[model samples]
Target: MRRIVGADAVCALIAGALGYLVRFGPAGTDGQHVSLGVALALPLVWVAAMLVARSYEERFLWVGADEFRRVFFASALLLATVGTVSWAFKLDVARGFVVLALPLATLLTLGQRYAQRQWLHRRRRHGLFRQTTLLVGHRAGVESLHQQLEREAYHGYRVVGCALPGGRDVAAQFDGLPVLGDLDEVVDIVRGFEVDTVAVLPSPELDGPALRRLGWDLEDTRAELLLAPAVTEVAGPRVRIRPVAGLPLLHMERPELTGVRRLTKGAFDRTSAALGILFLAPVLLGIALAVKVTSHGPVFFRQERVGRDGRTFSMLKFRSMVVGADRMVDDLAEESDGNGVLFKKKDDPRVTRVGKVLRRYSLDELPQLINVVRGDMSLVGPRPPLQGEVERYGYDMHRRFLVKPGLTGLWQVSGRSDLSWDDSVRIDVRYVENWSLTFDFMILWKTAGAVLRGSGAY
Candidate 1:
């Protein structure tokens, strides 16, 4: 499926580019052809959209809504550009032909994407084309890499464990695999692990010469060497690598927060929130009425939560449980799923009848957009831990305070109420450590689907 999408995309470009050339060639060469400018628009749009949507993340593709969405957006953008340019130049382009091509190209592109995904899925299941990685770095870094490989098994990278600095006393099982070796022993480790690739997760303090030497050493091994830059969760578009004389430097562009980006985000928040309220207003009203009528409590549950920069704000949600639910935390502590610090009950008696539906779909969180507009919270960010949760947090966990608590964050998207205290803290710390506008956008995008699926919601 991946190959088909890539091929179809390339074919679309060749076809579109060739079509343009044929149409515009000399005088009367090709009769009644679409204008060259219009013909070129199709492929250009596909390339641009593919780049933006990151369709090339993997080579062997499959059927995912993301694939189709990218194709549709690309097609739409291309046609829209064509229409605009035609109007501007007063070109005699047929609206019917342009309209007809949009859906045709989109369907073909989607079909190819689907076909490629199926092919890749089958190939992976048969172990025909699998990625074998030689992880190279410090013990901690290697251990982290090993765990990641184990977690995302479907991504198809099978780690034979890591190649550390020395063949020394690497624990018998680091993340349930023997440490193959260290940096000096990488070449030997690569062969022993039967790895086709090397991922360098070097110690943070690795000097330039050693770093360059690792790359040099991998040259003769006929294996791919990938530098797993300490940067994680930062989007690809925001990162740029530059090579100086015999030295490769990684330059990560700071996420833009001013001018058009700021404006776009602000506009997105306001417009989306406004429309959301419009569409969900009846539901919101109904929830509010239910809370008031059924429970002896306020319609909205307002709790003082830590926001951006550790500032305090009253976060709003539809009242799901009793008004004094906060007071029951101490008593309910023993009912938690995991750690004692964070309290949760699988089946709480305090929840109102309508609250279940509201909580399940995250409908209760709709009110937080008002907080977003008012600058008390962001649409996506770290979860706002309660003061008790914060007090219980280790030093490593306080990193979440660097940014405002989000309505939907890594914690919410990853597991929501099902997450343990440590897991919750880790997600927040990771978000704070690697927050970007693009990361936030991706989180927001995933959150929409996660909410609809209602996974782990309570």
Candidate 2:
């Protein structure tokens, strides 16, 4: 917490000083209006706003996007407070000073926090900051929870052992978490391992009163109680806990697919796509020229893809395959190394020499900006699926069409062509169910790293 606060303060101070210089050009007027006093106070005010916003809270800092979102809101609040004060007092504050300081502080502070998070991730990977957890459940449920904890180490849980119901499986084991004892000896296991958390998964033997009694028994110790729901892959934002009568019920809000939220997303997609095309004109043209010069086919390839509402659109791409490549699909069907529904061959003979390089780095997808602009696709959503792939879609698979397809999406950033059909479906459906402008931005940010690595791209 101290480190995070210090970094945030330092970044705020730097932004204030830089903004001061940009506004006043290093004037030696210390006591004058719009002077050093104002600059110094800006950092203090920003820090206070961050503190009030609880940006440095321990639970928020270690995981997820909420911490950074809080920081951003705090910065906005600081700016709003500054603006109000300046207006109310009719102070001669330069607009440029506030304008520059807010964004600079946000950028620098976000960068610093990202650096800290990476350091924390490295430490956590080495088992630092992890809780030695004792899980209580049936053998199957215990193992399920154990697998999840091991899979997501960032959650800070390390299963030390398991306690099965009724001493039945006391000598058994699930994965590597040995059945240290039964439910009756759960507290004993917690004491023995010096466990910091006792995670409870649903089992027939443990009912409501039994779990409450367990919690009461652990109250004398430092160990925390956690309930592991069987539900998986649901994001934090969607889950809401409500105390109805004496029962605590969990409700998941439906994904917002209509109304203003949907409209805002559409606006963002088209505007960003248009700006992207303008900014990358030189690179786009160069790629087009390269494709035309190095391949026998046209510079662009337009393929039919399923988009929102199961509508078909001609998704554009920089041609990276031989002319009449579609004709070769049947012949190479047996050679497919792709996920079941998608036809992907890592070393397809149809990919031209220039095509290999283009596909590897996803340079071929740049032309999809046109699709984005035309409203058939988004900048970030599901992977634009082929028409034939949609033909294999089961009943529930149609949920992916709730949003427009994307040039780069959860599927693209995750593993692209290397993803199994199930993996691809999971991520895309997750994206559809949890769509937000902030979440979209996060995916776009991760997309750069995925493209650079080129690990999964064909």
Candidate 3:
């Protein structure tokens, strides 16, 4: 916390100095003196604003978007306070300095926070700086929470033990962790184990009053209580806590399937795709030439893919197979290395020499930019599925058609061909349910690293 405060203060000071240099130049005068005074005071005020916004709170630190949101709030609050004070006091505050410094400081602070988060995540992955967590819930809920925490170890939750509803009588150990006690013994177990966090999963035994009491009991301990509601895979933006008649209710907003945000996403997709196409024209041409010369097939391979609303569109990709590769699907089906639904082979005989290189780095998907431009696809969304794959989809999987398929999506960045069918479905459905511009941007950013590594690309 102190480190974050210090970093933010330094960022504010640097921004102020830069703003002063840019706005007032190197001149030494009364104006310079006043600017220096303001610059000296800015960092202190900025840090205080961040404190008021609770940006440095441990709960908001090293995880989620809430920390960044608080930082932004602090920036806005600081700006408002400065403007109001300057206006009320008739102070000669430099407009350019305020404008430049505050925005720059916000950016710098956000950047520093992101860097710190990455560092923390790296440490957590190596089993450092993790919180000792104690689970309190039913057997099934405890097991599920434990598994999830194990999978996302970078979240810094080390599940030490669990306290089920029925305690040791139910089982000696749950999910390979020692069963501490029952739900009623959570606080005692936390204290005994020196737990850093107590995660309470939903259970019939823990009602409103009981949960409130548990919270009150944990107040004296160093452990923080975290409530893991039954709801899963929903993004924070979609869920809100609404207090009505003294009851806190979880309100989930309907996914934005058809609205102004969707329209904006479409616009962004088209604009970004068009710019991408223009920028990568040379690379596209080079790939086209390579495919044309190395393989006796069209430069582009057009395949029917299921898009939004189960609509079929001809998805484009640079040819990465022999001319009659599709005809040999049945013959090669037995040797498949894919996740049942998707047919992928690491060493398929149909792939040409140049095709191998194209598929490795995902250069083959470059032509999908045209699909994005034509509104048949998005830059980020559920992966476009083959018609056969769509036909085999379960009813819940159909929800992925709520938005257009993407050139790259959760599935792409996650593992691409290496992901199991169930994993792929889960990831796609998760994205479909939690669609947002920010989510898309995050997926797109991850896509770049995924492509570079080509970890799952066959």
Which candidate number has the best lDDT?
3
TM-score of 1: 0.74
Reference-based lDDT, residue 38, model 3? 81
Per-residue C-alpha lDDT of model 3 across residues 175-289, encoded as one tens digit per residue: 8999989888988998898999999988888988999999999999999989997888788889999998888899999998898999999999999999999999999999999
Ranking by TM-score: 3, 2, 1
Model 3 ranges with Cα > 4 A deviation: 329-335
- The clash tally of candidate 1 reads 14
Which candidate wins on TM-score? 3
TM-score of each: 0.74, 0.84, 0.93
Q: How accurate is candidate 1 locally (lDDT)?
A: 0.70
Looking at model 1, which ten-residue stretch has the lowest summed lDDT? 57-66
Best-to-worst ranking by lDDT? 3, 2, 1
lDDT of each: 0.70, 0.85, 0.90
Q: lDDT by residue for model 2 over 1-458, one digit each (tens)?
A: 88888888899899989988887778644434664667787667778988898988877887789888998999888888878987999887778878998899999999999999988877887899888898888878877677667656867887778888666444666677677888888888887889999988877677888888999999988899988776656788989998999789898888888999889989999999999999999999999999999878799998888889988989898999999999999999989999877888998899999999999999999999999999999999888888888888886578889888888888877778888787787788889888888889899999999999998888
Residue-wise C-alpha lDDT for candidate 1, range 1-458, written one tens digit per residue: 34554676665665554444444444534434545455556665666666666665543145335556666677777777778987998877766556655566666677666666667656765665668887777777877777666544545677776765554575655666667765678778776666788888847545677867877877877678777878665655557778978666778877554477656666666677777778878877887787789878788888888766667889898889977888886787777664566666767776777888788898888888788777677777788867766777788777777666788888777878777665676677777766666677778878987899898887
